[model samples]
Target: MDVNGDLVHGATLTAVLDGSTQPVGLLGALSQAHRIQRLELPVHTMLPVVLRQLMLPIMLDELKAPRDRREWGDRFNRGQFSADELERLEHYLGPHGYGDRFRLFDAERPFAQVAGLKALNGETKSVAQLVPSVASGNNVPIFSALCEADELRLEPGDAVLWLLHAHCWDTASIKTGAEGDPQASKGKTTGNPTGPLGQLGLVVPTGRTLYETLLLNTPVVPDGLAPDDRPHWAWDERPIGLGCNSPAAPAWSQRPATGLLDLLTFQARRVRMFTCETEQGLRVNRVIVSAGDRLTRTPEYDPHTVWQHVTKPKKNQPHQRPRRHISGRAAWQGLSTLLAMDLPEQSDGPYTSLLLRQIGDLRADEMLSEHYRLGAETSGLEYGTQSAVVENAIGDDLPLPVQALLAQDAWLREALLECVDQADQAARALDTLNNDLRRAAGGDPLPRDKGSKPSAQFLQSLDRTMRRLLVGLRTVGADESELLERGQLAWEQSVWHAATSDAGLLLAAAPPRAIVGRTVRNGNKDFVYRSGKASGLFRARLTDILPRAAEERRAAQKEGAAA
Candidate 1:
């Protein structure tokens, strides 16, 4: 897809390789030249995860060359993939790359497919089963327009795309047990885990162009690839159905990954794609899917996610876990953790994504231009009921400033954190006012949504202002101190106005009869509800929460007093 959303057919992987086109996921690639701005596709939980999986092989191989790693961004900007590098990359993703292993319909060695699995499983399921969004078995879509009766069909290319998607994000429903697998109780395997990527709120750092996006996501690992480190395609042996249990194809077990390469291309399911010759062409119609290798634990460096330090409950041990993405929350709301900014007095700051840290380093080194905006694309899956149902797909893209990415300047960093802190307090103050207003009305002091609606709106109203502040701080000729001061005041005023207006609206809607006064017995004393009393309390709370607002009010009062 181009910037105009018109699909350009015959665009090769080499085009993306040479920076001729942009890569598209849920959040499309940011373009410096403003060429390919967005790419639209069906919204599914596993699509982006599969896309990342596809890119990992090339990224891992590129990481192997130390000298080239240093100049990755520069080379990418200047028509990516040098003569030798492109050839090496072609050896992996090219049509003849890796021999027949890359072939989709090769009976002996299919791409990411277990050969002869249809015979081993004794039956085949529809291709719809390969896609998570389509209605299949117990995993039905609520909002999906298609029904089970709908005849689902896929082209060879679409089949391959969904084939990889299934392996990365298949639900943990009971599966058809293969003939020779001992793990199956009654011709079925139960208790399979969700896909590894399914368990994470993936944070992919996207750059201005396709090539830059790839380099930004490919963070440098201090410890180079281990001797055993190799992607699935480079493995000595291929998956041969559920019965074949080796280091490469560990069926129904959590195995420790060899290294980054192994983890990136981790096959979570054993799948076989079957095609039938239709009048149109060769159409993929059925599949056989079973369990495959699962990662023992989250790897230390996934380059694409933020990890939080956590402790196990039963064993009471400390470990780092990938932080889960919260549905409906914007990425900027998590600025503290996203940028790894140090909180008030906490010695250990948030666990930042390695990719984000790498971007910061690039900015610091002046490799990536400080003026170019960075995009942090987050993708996550919300699961339900033993991980059998796809509950929701969580995704958001935040166009971040370079300073926000680095957060190295002490004053600038502190100022940003302060604005975030003040906004949070102001929201909290608004919530308190809501409860007070409810009390004045002699109703339940606590509302069901807990004032989340107003608080969310308040924060959202500040989004544009915050981005502007970020841009202003980096303005070429502006004084840093003056910009900081003005930005802080602007943020405080915005918060104050939004919070106060929300509170005023709530108070205005209250019933006058209830707000006049109400007295109820509380243990041995009388508890009174009155609008006047709540109003006074709310004023105090707002003034305390928004000191800058209070200072401006004081200055205005002094001017009026002199008059």
Candidate 2:
């Protein structure tokens, strides 16, 4: 306690977040545990301070990887890096710190604690903004869970939804209605702000609770739900008994699914964090978002709804098992986002919207089928998701892609979807012909101007990006498989040309194939060398040669250090 009797508290962020009980994680242990109430402090106010401290170190890590580098102490004393890696590192993490005051040990800090703050701060605008905002244009959702008193509420059974729907209540005018008002002719009066919503539960303000309870009705876990995103701390809804960790392990096992998880980068956004007494000192536990409330908007979604889930600083059942609080709707939303975010910036807007709709609409059989096509192992569901089902999902029609596919078959009947030899005359001729045809068919044509063409390097990058995107957008009937193959081939060729340019190799002498260097064996003695490999490996005395080179490199490093 402080001199004035104010409570002084401190905490350590765990290496990984507690998946289940973290009311803040994607799927919390309790959708309706203890509602968030009676806070030690407003979460929004504390968030900025927390993020500011967390981001500084994470930014520093991107500046340099500390554990690998041998040098220590001051920035000048530390070693250097290539111009390219250094430039890239600065482009994202910023050059404000440079190498000054950055320590090698700082990079070794737990990533989850430091890394997630940037997203949270960006979403809430909790961080400092002295200069004109570079992030003002960003479409991040504004965080308002902590700003208002009695804003967040949990109305059980969705009876409020029935009343509101029946009464034809305008959602925009929620604050204006009263219980006995002559609002008119749905044969019912308008719903009150603080009163009952028909037969459902009352609009209870969000309160805090120590224990999160997941009322498990069925043993079946859903398919496409990512266990990696689930809580590692979850225990069965049973008594705290001994021998739980016996039988080689506990009765439970957790294997993370390889599906969608967009909130991984911005993890803390899903979690509701607060400090309270645990068996092991002050631990952070999150509040789960409860469902069944339909009359009032959820706190997180409503910017106008000021109240948030409350706090429970004291815990009576510290050893109680953290069970799963399952809500089908929230779980589905979380999993759909996770699956759709397989590519860069995929979580943003119409792209993610399209993907989520498509994935959610796919059957479990279809998901598994698509999973195999994406080059993942289809051995078995073994991840506790074997019984998962996608309910009432009908696939959406993709008009543009369908049109593009139909025209591709109709106009360019020559099948230019070949995946090799971009530099060959026949391939170039086909490509030019395809472009002209695509233009005639009102599709995206290859860019051309002046008497010259785009560099092979540009063609490669564009083709690669377009291919990955086009492949992801593939539906059950779309003929995108061959298209994607061609794209991959183009990207590979572009990368090859770029590398050759970098190495200053003679483009005329270079063969079209990735392989180079003629076999020069001494009178048929069996030996092979592949110049196409990432590392040059002459495969005869490979073991001896590599060891000797390694030894020499170590010696050189030692000599350099000694000097």
Candidate 3:
């Protein structure tokens, strides 16, 4: 599919637009200049009935061919799949209908397979292996990608980050040619690009040593399934992406920032290849890509000292456990940095007081810190008391009646108490969100986008207020910006409140008897609100408390005077 998610078929030769150019250039290959031999179809490959009907007679007549055959009959042979009509297929029909048609995107990206850092054994080697070195039948000898740190231009001695691509083929050799030296024979045409030999390239950053290219294709037989097949499959071919390696491409070039989508598509394929591994016994564990670490013994050292030095949990630390480590931390970091920009938009939060409370609670769980690699400190918080942190967060976001309370001595205490009440309310609001988060943690992390939930009692109310305050920024109306802004505002406000207010004091206060303030239970993390005043000095009626109004009302009214 294109960037906009439109589907592309064989006929749709989507123009590769070069955004880096002054006027974006649509890439067109010089198909006329470079004549490619039309590859013959495999004898065993069951072509769709229509194609077989047309090509079978042609295949039988290799000795006597028509001159116009290259124009039409062998267009599919040369991998020219341009068509105006869509060819529907039903693999279940077993060639009664067309099936498994070839698709070529006409997009050839050159990726280098760089090698030759000193091996773990400290053996310095000159040779670097870059695989799939054949870029559209031309041997790529050098890569611009390896030449500089975020710069264009190629040079020798550049530390190149390359994909050690290992691609496997079902067939041994479709097209093999030789001319001069083994090295010289590279650029010269070889192997049939369009053949039964399906290729798979699993890429991983080189570790302590250059991995030896190995092919162990365990012929996989298909399972007849109306069945529940696990990830571990019975196979005719092994999950082998590490098939070959080559030196730097002779010509290196930068994939411009504008070509990020292309880069992502390429790398995502690499990720898929890397993740497909040797099938395990019954239960196959999925490989999740993250940072990569180096072997401590290697001369070409990398930071992963933690990975090397701390292979197991520390002594007497029950909380710590050995887990997965990244292969190339640096490479992974760089890759992730590039990919992060493409990630979906996220709401800025800590806007609603509820979120901070959740974060604080998550931190207290201890397991959360371990899961997220947040040592000791919880997410966004460190070393401070959680209660104090929550108190502060709520204070920053709470709207106090500043103008009305400014002259009064009792304002500070009253505002503080009000904040405590808000905290209690926020806690209840967080319940739905907490439930959702907990459900997510329990593994149902899907439906990447969600609708605006107006049902959240306290959170929704707070968001409404935040939206009203943020009316100046709204172009479409406060609802849109506020809806988005509230989450971030919540966090920011929480921070402001935490730094400036004593709202959390209400948290420790006993529950107010009847909705004035109260305790709300959430397992161990209980929100304690200040209890309501009962017949206290501050609760006196205005007539009883004030002399002037009290005397006037007393004289004007009967036994009961309005206060």
Pick by lDDT: which candidate is best?
A: 1
Comparing 2 and 3 by TM-score, which wins?
2
> TM per model?
0.83, 0.20, 0.17
Best-to-worst order by lDDT is: 1, 2, 3
Q: Which candidate would rank higher by TM-score, 1 or 3?
A: 1
Candidate 1 per-residue lDDT, tens place, 211-305, comes to 55666666565566676666776766433432324422314466766677777777888787777777886677888887777777777767677
Q: What overall lDDT, based on C-alpha atoms, would model 2 receive against the true structure? A: 0.23
Give the Å error, residue 545, model 2. Answer: 28
Q: All candidates' lDDT scores?
A: 0.65, 0.23, 0.21
Residue-wise C-alpha lDDT for candidate 2, range 1-563, written one tens digit per residue: 11111111111111112332221211111111234221121111121122222221232224331221121122212122335534554443332522211111122221121212122112322111100111111211134233322222211111111111212111111121111223322322222221111111111111012110000000111232333321111212212431121111101111221112111111111111122344543322222110111222211211011121223313642211111112212211111222222223322221122212222233221321232222110000001112111111111111112212222132211122222222232224333433333333333446664333323333343444434533443342335556545444444444344433422332232244324433334586832322333122212222232333345546879999999
Supply the global lDDT for candidate 1. 0.65
Q: How many residue pairs clash in each candidate?
A: 0, 26, 51
- Count of backbone collisions in candidate 1: 0
lDDT of 2 at 65: 18
> Which one is best on TM-score?
1
